[model samples]
Target chain A: MTAPLLRIENLSVEFGPRANPIRVVDDVSFEIEAGGSVGVVGESGSGKSMTSLSILRLVPEPPGRISGGRILFDGADLLALPRNQMPDIRGRDVAMIFQEPMSSLNPVMTIGDQIGEAILLHQDLNSAQRRKRVLELLRLVGIPDPAGRIDAYPHQFSGGMRQRVMIAMAVACNPRLLIADEPTTALDVTIQAQVLALLKDVRQRLGTAILLISHDLGIIADSCERVVVMYAGRVVEEGDVRSIFRNPAHPYTRALLKSIPRLDDERDRLYQIPGSVPLAGSVTQGCAFRARCPLRVETCAVDRPPLFAFGPSHKAACWVTAEAAQARSAAEASP
Target chain B: MARYIFWRLADSIPTVLLVLTLVFIAMRILPGDPAIAALGDNALPDQIAVFREKMGLNVPLWRQYLNFLHGVVTLDLGRSLISNTPVVNLLAHHLPYTIELTIAATLIGVTAGIPMGVLAATHRNRPADSAVRLYSLVGYAIPDFYLGALLLIVFSLNLGWFPINGGGDDFPSRMYHIVLPALTLAFLKSAFMGKLARTSLLEVFGKDYVRTARAKGAREGRVIYRHALRNAMLPLTTGLGMSLLATLSGSVAVELVFNRPGIGTLLISGISERDYAVIQGGVIVFALFVVVVNLMIDLLYIVVDPRIRVQ
Candidate 1:
């Protein structure tokens, strides 16, 4: 197979002193094939957002730094790219839509100008051409009366419409990859569905890969084809969306899936995970999720488990399940 | 917009009236009698009575107040008791000097101060930022009058770079004479503007939209100037209005030290001579300036920030 469009290998983002740093994103490894969708699902402080930010090198430094990473996008190592050249790649090749649509946009700038800015940065378009493109982008993102609303400030638009405008700007250059960091978290439930649908539609129309970061499993399940479940800065499980949802191997993943309330089950209280995620870099030598995992073993405390295969594309980072899967596979081969 | 201006103008009437009343009261409360000030302390009682009668001071206090109000409304400020010149002409002659000093000082302050602030903010916590901070600190610590004396001694006395006294003749010399006093006032004014702009720009730099602009692959200069600076201007506009008024007031002390004949010097002389007409006129003019400036700032708010409406 051809190389994936975006390959992130053992990316680590840290904060505080370098002598004893707090690693927010530790050894995060993932990839997105061209035009494919992947979701990084985790609770708050699980490093999913940092992981996405590291792709565009947008992490605020001094407090937070991408300490180590090989982010290879389109056969180039992004981590090694010069600071000045990075701008050329960002918004041109990899665009991002942030969580807060209300503040993400420049309050003083007109919507048309903001969207046109993205196109103007990369493309050699004149004022008229850029304006035309901006109008077209507005229409594509489902903003009504694109021409009339073009001159309106950010305060004029509602939350959902603002997100739509954000999406329109992100996709203006037809970027190869779109990193959406909880793009719909701030929207209403009904509006959330509309935004997610619009994202999917944009992905299809522009043929852009998406790295969706969200805490909500429902959002991930609805929008992404592949899922990477992260717990305390480490990926606990990653696989095809169907396999991971149906046969979750990591204890954290299983608990997360069970926590979702189902109308058919008729439960009195919605299931909740037993323990909160550990602070980053707190569990140095052991598994990050061991405190919260139901299937924790002695081995889990002493050594961190690597991603062990359960099938061709499904893997889980767990001492108990991964070892069991390994022994069962070996036994089947021997027989 | 017109309606907003009209209402603002209406609002200023009460303020002007209060200032006029305060000037009237303050003149009356002062120790020297108007007749004694105009004539002499040893004048005959009949002569004093004739002077009071002519000036309308012998009438009841209510009637005198009504006459004063009528004079204000009719723009009949009467002649200066000392100079015998019409108070309006005296003001018209000297008002230009104060206005020139204020405008020149403001121009210098904004032009110098904004760039200094931009530098300090962009290089926050760096050596350059520290240097700017230190400059502003020194600028604030020194009073403009003291600084004006130092400049006068250094540039005018020692070096003979400028003339020692007088408001200067012709447009060129006026520009020349304005430099020292304007600079003295501007020294403090720029310090204020620099501090204000630095704080405002620093706050805008931390906002989410600035980060968004950077994420859009905008050049650092573009992100700062196009996105951040415009937003920063809202607070800076308010600060500028206040600083302009401050500069106007500060010019008074600087004018005394420099011996330039401006409105402040005129008012001071009027106060010493107990020239009630000149004092009242000067106070009213200053009060009106305050009102007009505030109105202009309100108008500027609409231009700087689109969210604000005239209503």
Candidate 2:
């Protein structure tokens, strides 16, 4: 019944001078249904965070700029919003969680005070109501002894707990969307699971659409319903969680899937994606992943591929996907 | 935090003592008899010797040191050889002027430098940032004395905007005179502070917390002053502390250019006449003031930021 919460179209971000901009987000588009979860998976410098930052208009300054983009949130053009209106929108309609929990929360302020600060900024809650809501938010985030711990500083918290505090602050105003940018990367595996579970629970309770960003496939698998794969600042593949896991089309996407170590894998060796994420400034012609792709062909080196649909919900950008699939079948049949 | 303060205070005591000791040894060991220097080139050797004995110059080095230590302990600064009055009295009269000048300069330096630094960092690599950098560079190039003279000529002599020299008989006029000297002193120090603030702010702006603040939707102004600027001020705090002492202690040049009766001028005239009491008094007082100012700066570290106090 509710319209899709967000729709991004042809979003390209560039960092560096306008004369020769280093493109980081290249015409990436996707949609998140209301209360839906989308996982943006990629490695460091893969522009996952940049995508989220572009959505929030939080890209690092001067050299970095949104060169071209149209971000539609519930049919409203986000990029078209005036600069003065952004503060009113942020924390009211949307909020974000950062990667480093230890530093994300202001160390100098009490957890209670930090949460109250956001509420005060975005909501019309008075002092007493603010205090009550802060405690409620803390409790909602599963912080034990909420009353006692409200006055504690960020330094007093463990990594997992600090992240919970960050979530509480982000969710203080019950925003419609919450972007978690590598929200649990720094935590241990167990803590990561806990954090992911907490996020899942929060989304269920508040009906908040989550845009989860992480490099780990396991994190994406557990925390997201749809997956968007980024490479060299472009979406190489995107699909529903089921289709993406079962059959990935892009070489980069397939390579990424194979790179994840499995407990029941062959005894020979763990597969690697072979090459690094291309340096953002150096990608000049054709596909940025062409240099390392296994499905390389003449077209791969000469012309960049556009996204082609494999299924209604799945799409990929690869020059020789058809040939690569036929060749893969021939090799499998020969073996 | 209390322990940190106690240790910082403890560390400063020896610094004060060592400086006074150096001042004592350096003044006494220099190859010139105060008696001859005070009495003039034509004075008889016997007359100089009598003056030395009367002034306790005949005592051994260790004994004189003991006497000096005793005087310091008892807070007895003794008489000014040049003024023929208590060194404490002379210092009390002139010290206020220098202190006022130093405070004014420091206030100017901090206010101007901090904002300039913030602006430079925010608009880094742009014309505004470059302009601030250029200003500090120019500040560095011009000598304080030359700047002081130029200011006097332009603002005082030609413009008739202020009295050319001295605080004068009235408190307000004296304060007005101090303004030019303070501005000259601040101009030099502020460039350094401004550059430090800018570079430091830029660095802090790169920090993860700053990124976090931006993501949290803090306004640009809030992200800068409230978030990035506070952390950047840590380094400035340390540098400014030491500079405060240097500016206050080195008021001699500007004071001379402006005919202000500050401790620097007092010390210069005292040394010229071999006025040992004035020299001792000036050195000890200046040393103690430096020590105390540094201590206050350390204490201020916790106040400018709550995180430091938390640590």
Q: Could you report the Cα RMSD, in angstroms, for every candidate shown? A: 2.0, 3.4
Tens digit of per-residue lDDT, candidate 2, span B69-179: 787787777776666798878888888888888888999988898899888888888999999999999988998899999999999999999789986658877777888
Model 2: residues >4 Å from true position, as ranges? A266-268, A281-287, A297-299, A319-335, B40-50
Q: Write the per-residue lDDT of candidate 1 for residues A251-314, one digit (tens) a residue.
A: 9989989998887988899988777778778878889888777788899899989998888899
TM-score (C-alpha, index-matched) for candidate 2: 0.92
Total colliding residue pairs, candidate 2: 2
TM-score of each: 0.96, 0.92
Task: Please state the CAPRI-style docking class of candidate 1.
Answer: medium
Superposed by TM-score, candidate 1 places the C-alpha of residue A206 at a distance from the truth, in angstroms, of 1.0
For residues A1-335, could you state the per-residue lDDT of candidate 2 as single tens digits? 56689998999889888888888888889889988999999888888898898887888767688888799988998899998777777777889998899877765567887788788878888999999999999999999999999988778899999999989988988888999999999999899988999999999999999999999987898788999999888888898888888998888878888888888888578888776778885776788899898878888878878887777788888868856665777898997
| Model 2 CAPRI rating | acceptable
Candidate 1 deviant stretches above 4 angstroms: A330-335, B1-6, B28-33, B36-40, B60-63
